[model samples]
Target: MTSLNEIPARTESVELEPLREDKKKIFEDILRYFETNQRGYIKVPTGWGKTFLSKHIMKKYYDEGKLMLFLVSKNNPLLSQAYYNRKKNQPLFPNSALLYSERRVDRKELAATLRALGQKKGEGFVLFASLQTILGKQSAEIKDLILKFTDLAIVDEIHNFINNRGNDFLNEFGERTKILGMTATPFQGVVGNVKFVDEIAGDMREIYTKTLPECILDNELAPLKYTIAESSEDIFEIFDFEKGLGELDRQDLFLDCSTPDRLKKVIRRTQLAKDVYDSMVKQRHAKTLVFCAPVRKRVYGVGGGDKEINAFHAKLTSSIFNGDISAKKLEKDIEPVLPVDFKNYTPEGKFRDAVFISSELPKDEQNAILAAFREMGKPPYVLCTVGMLIEGFDFPGLETLILLRPTLSMRLFEQQVGRVTRLSPISGKQQGSIFEISDSIDSLYQRFGEGVFSGEKVDQVQMLQPEIRLEELFSEGDAARAIEEGKIEIKKVELGLRGKGKGVKIKEVPVKLPPTSIRAKYFSRLLALTEEKDVGAFEREKRELMRAALKFRVRELRDAEELAKLAANVNKLKREAYEDRRLGDVSRQHKPKVFGEVEWLLKLQALNSLKYEGEHLSLQEKNRILKTLGFEPDFRKIDSHRLKCLKLGSAHKTIPELVKVLGFVSRLSSSETYQFLDKKKKEQWKRELLPAVYWGFCFIEDSPELKDLFESTEWDRRVKNIIRQK
Candidate 1:
């Protein structure tokens, strides 16, 4: 065990400019806020260099001789990102350490080193630990040691730290400690409720739309498209608060899906999705990603079971270890599973083996699988877990994503999509494709609707678009021409002679012409001619065409420039403006109003209307009363007064008085009437009043009435209710 006393006092700093102007401003604001207050929250989207910023901040404090603790989620990818950032950009932290599940170190030695670095007896040094390790008590001693020296703490994936299990750590740190919580998804429920020492930094939509989305759409980065599948049954029922939530909390129910039978169901569904992917690949020859749930196998008698059974299992394991398995099985079982239709799959000599990657595999095995998959000829596909692929894994040849799992959280869904969206460095192409097979449309909608709702944003849900028959795109003659052209490139490579040795000139025998370039041109022409009459349609076609062309191009272009240009063109089409333009002007004009309407609807109050006449109100009379109260009245615009009245219901207010007011409810429930009057007398809490306040900067400049209402106590109660609802 490493002791704190042995650790050296080595810390260094690096100068870094923010990746973008907005980022720079946001970074400065965050730093300034922290400088004044000692703690703050910064919300920036993934790929926006949050890790870089964290490192920069760490370096700043390290240079000042303050002990800073950088905390991250237990996720391996995130840990890897931190490690890479430190190693490459901030290399001066000789005392820095990584705490994760796989890494083991001597605690005594570490502690001694920390002590030597002035960490003991109220001294401190920087330490890195995953939230899980911290929470699990694995790093209890280290955590305590750091606590002595800790002046500041940086929390990554802050949202995860707010959950019930994580709250303990937060509470432990408490008000005394200055803490910074960082997350891309800042609004887990209500934005205001999220804890921050002083200030919240950056706008989520602005950063995503202006920075990340632009990079993706411009093919400066990898582009992503989503495909939503409508569900036949309401999947929400399975996640209902009363029943499903409790079940999810229980280990048995949560892990039940990992059972062999349940896994079979998943496998069957995955195979069906894989079949669709296969047809697409055959038609276009594209690389693809196959995401699956975690694999947990119970080797019944492997390690410490019955002696006879253990011996047999041990023998089998040893056989696997010694390479007794044939190359075919080694390729099949050891290598990552590639997306191929085994039912009628015939490899074209190039793809001899498929790759299978899983988190369950040992690190050596995982590396070997990746190497084998990469070594396979063009149009290689790999089967990987959602867990492993969501973070650090980058394969440029990945042009297609086969979504085998459905997720609702936009952050997770987007991250998974991002795996394929990264421009394949190998091919230098900008865009990728996705093939999603789901039983439910709502699931698809939830996963893909965010960007679509933003009129200025391109709909990324094109990955799920159904495949169209390619026969109509070209005649047999055209197909033949493409095939011939593709073969020509192969012939050129094969016919070129080379000297194998001195005085031995090898006559290069003509190699069989491969259908690569011809296929790419055919796919490109097919894409160009593909009719897209709507934004949704255009996005779908654009992604598919890009996938096909890039898959072919990856084989031809060894140069980066050509690949980048191809990628850029594909990315441009994925943009909302570009897709909308392709769909014609009507879409562009309607987008803003549609978003505005949705926003308005979210703020509307639920009410029943009634009409009254004299002492007794007939059904018809009650209907008239309801109609007069603006319950169902047709309103052309959503203005301040109307919005207020919608939020604050009326209760048996005089119709004439209501009509006199610019916006008033003629009738409301008795309860509402009392509540409204009560609300009028209270002091407002500005942060709690407007429902749109949760939208942060969007409603910051709300009308005076809204601003005043928000400052009242009544607004606080309403905000609490909204938080509870979330």
Candidate 2:
């Protein structure tokens, strides 16, 4: 709870430059509009000093004895960007304080600061708040504090709040306060289920806008050299169902990084970016900035692609650039051994681990890396980021931007492209280079609009045709080679399971089956049998053989020759299962006729064993098992010994008397029970024991056991109907 009172005042001084004539006019026009309007938004390009203009205007209101609130979303570097700007431009608001989640205000200190500022005329206090922090779980008190003290609110990156959560916070400040929202892209086109432009218009009026073209024309920003390379469909189709993915909702698939199939696409796209960077621009360095596709986890996982055939995975490539030599061991063996104190010791011209930054990183660590990246001839000469560096962040030395992910949001695309557009005289940067890796350049041109990056030169946007197509680099044999070389970790993916072809590449399987489909499940099991170690398959086969032998015994089949024949047939089926050969041929030829209505009881036992281990049984399996076991499978409470004794003509005695005479055989240990009964009776009971105790016992109407069985059956039926949508 570091409050304003605990924080030190800014003592350093900064020389200020007079705003350019065009920028000065735009700034004054925004002030003039705010004088008449209560609420409005300003749209301007990224490098146009939007933060300075807004803060300058807020200071005017602050001088008029008004309390101002500067707001941005949580995890937004803008909050910190504004904080640093405040330190540089101390004359803007002398009594300003930060109110983000990381550095919260003490309630008492905040009240005192506001109270003192409130007492004096022409004195104001600005609370720079993070919307994500103020509107979270413990937001009631903080929201009340903001509403009580704030007179005017200036929201930055306003496009982020075009949702119910944002509206609810906005609605809290009714007519008592005036609002002004600012963003480079005022309307974000269409996002998810709604039209974002209409939503923004309903909330605030768009008073001003400055496009990239206008900014470039005014010489306010650097000219950009754009290049596009379409990723090969053949490389993508190397993974199953990727070709058919065109028919599916691509936007939804893109967001879902949970599945290995989708993640493989992202990895291949990233690998293409790496190749393009290596061939086109790695030597020049020139402070490259890379934007990668979103991943669920930033660290270790199975990433599919081949370099023995052609591509470097996302994690491995990042580790190489980041100078994190240790991470490479997950994919392959480490090459040269490094000094123990490597991270802190940057020997001579050796690069360091500042090459990668993402939203998943801690704020302080991200800030330190960003600071390093901003400097010219730095360790992170080539920097990679997920999405954190796209908006608000300023880096004049960014001369190269590589986009590895495609976006449907025009605003986001513009923001990503704008990162490298800032002019840097010290670095002698006249133009920025943008290398885009995607499947279609025509679709990009159509989606982002034509001539979006038009410059004074005729060849502003260049299309670089790859000499060796991505598809040409891949072969069906490369996947197995990469796995053998330990470059690709083989994941136990539950896809493409049913095919019987041994050593079949996953890319060749083109059928698209839902993850939960019965066919997909069978395929996964089949894949495990063929691709994985034989231990699991052997255990499963042994269990099946033992269960079959028990079934023959239960059926009163005493022929040793028939038993031997059944064991041999089971062994053949097991061998075929491991060999990826069809089981039907062998089964039909030597299969036993032991499968009957009573055999369903043995199936129940097998299915129940799976349940006992907490494995998920499919709908068909669940129904079959439930139908055989009488639903509720608990048997510990059933008086099996008492029932057996009563059936053997001991019904005249009470339950207690029977327990005293028969000694509760189920509760007694095996050796103790055998001592109580003769050898013949003991063997007979042992053979028929468990099933007789569990289901062979009789139950009358209104009994608790009977009620539980009925309830469990009804519940199973209800669940099955719901799951099947019956």
Model 2 residue runs over 4 Å out of place are 6-16, 85-92, 115-121, 136-142, 188-194, 197-203, 234-272, 295-314, 319-350, 359-364, 440-726
Off by over 4 Å in 1: 1-22, 84-92, 115-125, 135-138, 174-177, 187-221, 228-272, 279-287, 293-354, 370-380, 386-388, 391-398, 408-411, 423-427, 440-726
Residue 628: error of model 1 in Å?
Answer: 19
Tens-place lDDT digits, model 1, residues 1-726: 333443444533444554566556755666676655644566543554566767766766766666667787656656655654443554235557666666665665765655555534333346776767765555677666665556678887666664455555655553335677776544332211233221132111122222344444333455443332222333332122234222222211111122233323333344444334433344343555566433233322222332222112112212222223322333334222222112111245442223445445578866665655554254234444435556445565666666544443344554555566455557654456665554432343343333222221111222121211111111112232333333111111111113453321212222221233333333333333332234432333332332232222111212212333333333343344443644556545433322232222222211110110012334454334324333443322323433453333221122233233311211221234425754443222221122133322122233444344333333233343332222
Superposed Cα RMSD, model 1: 19.1
User: For residues 1-726, could you state the per-residue lDDT of candidate 2 as single tens digits?
Assistant: 675665444333223446768767977887787676667788777887888777666766766767788898754467766755544544345567777667666856765666655555365667788887777665556577677667788888888776557656876775657778888765443221123322533446777877665565566777655555555533233222232323122211122233444444444445555545555564454788777654333212333332120112233346545535432232342223222222322566444633566545577876777777777776667677655667776887888887665554445666887788788887888677787664532222233232212210001111111111111111112322332333322121111223564321222111111111222222223223322323321322222222222221111112222333333433454454444434354443322221221223233323333344223345454344333333333333223432442343222233344333222333332343445777877544433332222222222121454334322322222121111110
Per-prediction CA RMSD (Å): 19.1, 23.7
lDDT of each: 0.40, 0.47
Index of the highest-TM-score prediction: 2
Q: What lDDT would candidate 1 get against the real structure?
A: 0.40
